[model samples]
Target: MTDEATQRLQDAEEHKKSYDGIMGAATEVGVPGALGLTMMFTSLVMANGVLLSILAGVAVYVLSHIIVKMFFSHH
Candidate 1:
Protein backbone atom coordinates (compact mmCIF):
# COMPACT_ATOMS: atom_id res chain seq x y z
CA MET A 1 0.00 0.00 0.00
CA THR A 2 2.85 2.44 0.69
CA ASP A 3 4.44 1.65 -2.66
CA GLU A 4 1.17 2.21 -4.42
CA ALA A 5 0.73 5.59 -2.79
CA THR A 6 4.21 6.63 -3.78
CA GLN A 7 3.56 5.63 -7.38
CA ARG A 8 0.28 7.49 -7.41
CA LEU A 9 1.94 10.62 -6.01
CA GLN A 10 4.64 10.43 -8.68
CA ASP A 11 2.03 10.07 -11.38
CA ALA A 12 0.15 13.11 -10.10
CA GLU A 13 3.35 15.17 -10.06
CA GLU A 14 4.14 14.16 -13.65
CA HIS A 15 0.66 15.20 -14.73
CA LYS A 16 1.06 18.56 -12.99
CA LYS A 17 4.34 19.14 -14.78
CA SER A 18 2.74 18.38 -18.13
CA TYR A 19 -0.14 20.71 -17.36
CA ASP A 20 2.27 23.51 -16.51
CA GLY A 21 4.17 22.91 -19.77
CA ILE A 22 0.97 23.07 -21.83
CA MET A 23 -0.13 26.24 -20.09
CA GLY A 24 3.23 27.84 -20.77
CA ALA A 25 3.00 26.95 -24.44
CA ALA A 26 -0.51 28.33 -24.67
CA THR A 27 0.58 31.57 -23.01
CA GLU A 28 3.50 31.98 -25.42
CA VAL A 29 1.35 31.36 -28.50
CA GLY A 30 -1.59 33.44 -27.28
CA VAL A 31 0.47 36.58 -26.57
CA PRO A 32 1.98 36.73 -30.07
CA GLY A 33 -1.34 35.89 -31.70
CA ALA A 34 -3.04 38.74 -29.90
CA LEU A 35 -0.23 41.16 -30.71
CA GLY A 36 -0.33 40.21 -34.40
CA LEU A 37 -4.06 40.72 -34.57
CA THR A 38 -3.81 44.10 -32.88
CA MET A 39 -1.04 45.15 -35.25
CA MET A 40 -3.11 44.11 -38.24
CA PHE A 41 -6.00 46.16 -36.99
CA THR A 42 -3.80 49.18 -36.35
CA SER A 43 -2.24 48.91 -39.80
CA LEU A 44 -5.64 48.81 -41.44
CA VAL A 45 -6.85 51.79 -39.47
CA MET A 46 -3.76 53.84 -40.27
CA ALA A 47 -3.40 52.75 -43.90
CA ASN A 48 -3.81 56.25 -45.30
CA GLY A 49 -0.12 57.27 -44.96
CA VAL A 50 2.79 55.03 -44.16
CA LEU A 51 4.97 57.81 -42.73
CA LEU A 52 2.25 59.04 -40.41
CA SER A 53 1.43 55.50 -39.34
CA ILE A 54 5.06 54.74 -38.51
CA LEU A 55 5.49 58.00 -36.62
CA ALA A 56 2.35 57.41 -34.59
CA GLY A 57 3.35 53.86 -33.81
CA VAL A 58 6.79 54.90 -32.64
CA ALA A 59 5.38 57.67 -30.51
CA VAL A 60 2.93 55.35 -28.82
CA TYR A 61 5.62 52.73 -28.23
CA VAL A 62 8.01 55.23 -26.69
CA LEU A 63 5.33 56.69 -24.50
CA SER A 64 4.27 53.26 -23.33
CA HIS A 65 7.84 52.36 -22.42
CA ILE A 66 8.27 55.57 -20.49
CA ILE A 67 5.01 55.06 -18.60
CA VAL A 68 5.85 51.50 -17.75
CA LYS A 69 9.32 52.39 -16.56
CA MET A 70 7.98 55.22 -14.46
CA PHE A 71 5.50 52.97 -12.67
CA PHE A 72 8.01 50.17 -12.29
CA SER A 73 10.52 52.47 -10.69
CA HIS A 74 8.16 53.22 -7.84
CA HIS A 75 8.29 49.63 -6.70
Candidate 2:
Protein backbone atom coordinates (compact mmCIF):
# COMPACT_ATOMS: atom_id res chain seq x y z
CA MET A 1 0.00 0.00 0.00
CA THR A 2 1.05 3.60 -0.56
CA ASP A 3 2.51 5.53 2.39
CA GLU A 4 -0.41 7.99 2.26
CA ALA A 5 -2.94 5.16 2.48
CA THR A 6 -1.11 3.59 5.40
CA GLN A 7 -1.01 6.92 7.22
CA ARG A 8 -4.72 7.45 6.74
CA LEU A 9 -5.52 3.99 8.11
CA GLN A 10 -3.35 4.59 11.17
CA ASP A 11 -5.06 7.93 11.81
CA ALA A 12 -8.49 6.31 11.59
CA GLU A 13 -7.51 3.60 14.07
CA GLU A 14 -6.14 6.14 16.52
CA HIS A 15 -9.29 8.21 16.24
CA LYS A 16 -11.45 5.19 16.96
CA LYS A 17 -9.37 4.21 19.94
CA SER A 18 -9.54 7.67 21.45
CA TYR A 19 -13.28 7.86 20.85
CA ASP A 20 -13.85 4.54 22.58
CA GLY A 21 -11.71 5.56 25.55
CA ILE A 22 -13.59 8.82 25.98
CA MET A 23 -16.93 7.03 25.81
CA GLY A 24 -15.87 4.44 28.38
CA ALA A 25 -14.61 7.08 30.76
CA ALA A 26 -17.79 9.10 30.40
CA THR A 27 -19.95 6.06 31.16
CA GLU A 28 -17.88 5.01 34.16
CA VAL A 29 -17.48 8.39 35.82
CA GLY A 30 -19.25 11.22 34.07
CA VAL A 31 -22.86 10.22 34.68
CA PRO A 32 -22.73 9.74 38.43
CA GLY A 33 -20.51 12.76 38.94
CA ALA A 34 -22.89 14.95 37.01
CA LEU A 35 -25.87 13.63 38.94
CA GLY A 36 -24.24 14.27 42.27
CA LEU A 37 -23.23 17.75 41.29
CA THR A 38 -26.69 18.53 40.09
CA MET A 39 -28.29 17.31 43.30
CA MET A 40 -25.86 19.24 45.44
CA PHE A 41 -26.35 22.39 43.47
CA THR A 42 -30.10 22.13 43.67
CA SER A 43 -30.08 21.62 47.42
CA LEU A 44 -27.67 24.42 48.12
CA VAL A 45 -29.27 26.89 45.81
CA MET A 46 -32.76 26.35 47.24
CA ALA A 47 -31.57 27.68 50.63
CA ASN A 48 -34.76 26.50 52.30
CA GLY A 49 -35.19 24.20 55.29
CA VAL A 50 -32.91 21.20 55.41
CA LEU A 51 -35.75 18.73 55.00
CA LEU A 52 -37.15 20.58 52.05
CA SER A 53 -33.71 20.76 50.43
CA ILE A 54 -33.23 17.04 50.80
CA LEU A 55 -36.60 16.32 49.28
CA ALA A 56 -35.94 18.67 46.40
CA GLY A 57 -32.61 17.06 45.73
CA VAL A 58 -34.13 13.60 45.71
CA ALA A 59 -36.88 14.72 43.38
CA VAL A 60 -34.39 16.31 41.01
CA TYR A 61 -32.28 13.20 41.01
CA VAL A 62 -35.18 10.93 40.22
CA LEU A 63 -36.55 13.22 37.54
CA SER A 64 -33.13 13.52 35.91
CA HIS A 65 -32.68 9.77 35.93
CA ILE A 66 -36.01 9.23 34.26
CA ILE A 67 -35.35 11.88 31.68
CA VAL A 68 -31.92 10.52 30.86
CA LYS A 69 -33.23 6.97 30.60
CA MET A 70 -36.07 8.00 28.35
CA PHE A 71 -33.86 10.02 26.05
CA PHE A 72 -30.77 7.84 25.95
CA SER A 73 -32.11 4.32 26.30
CA HIS A 74 -30.22 1.71 24.31
CA HIS A 75 -32.44 -0.42 22.09
User: What TM-score would each prediction reach against the true structure?
Assistant: 0.47, 0.53
| Tens-place lDDT digits, model 2, residues 1-75 | 699999999999999999978876665456645775677677778777677766666676666666655665673
Best model per lDDT: 2
* lDDT to native, each model: 0.62, 0.71
In angstroms, the error of model 1 at 37 is 2.1
Clashing pairs in 2: none
User: What is the number of backbone collisions in each predicted candidate, taken in the order shown?
Assistant: 0, 0
Candidate 1 local lDDT, 1-75, one digit each (tens): 999999999999999999878865554444444544455458658674666655555555555555545654643
* Model 1 stretches with alpha carbons more than 4 Å out: 41-75
Candidate 1 lands at a TM-score of: 0.47
How big is the RMSD of model 1? 6.2
Model 2 error, position 33 (Å): 0.4
Query: How well does candidate 2 score on lDDT at residue 11?
Result: 100
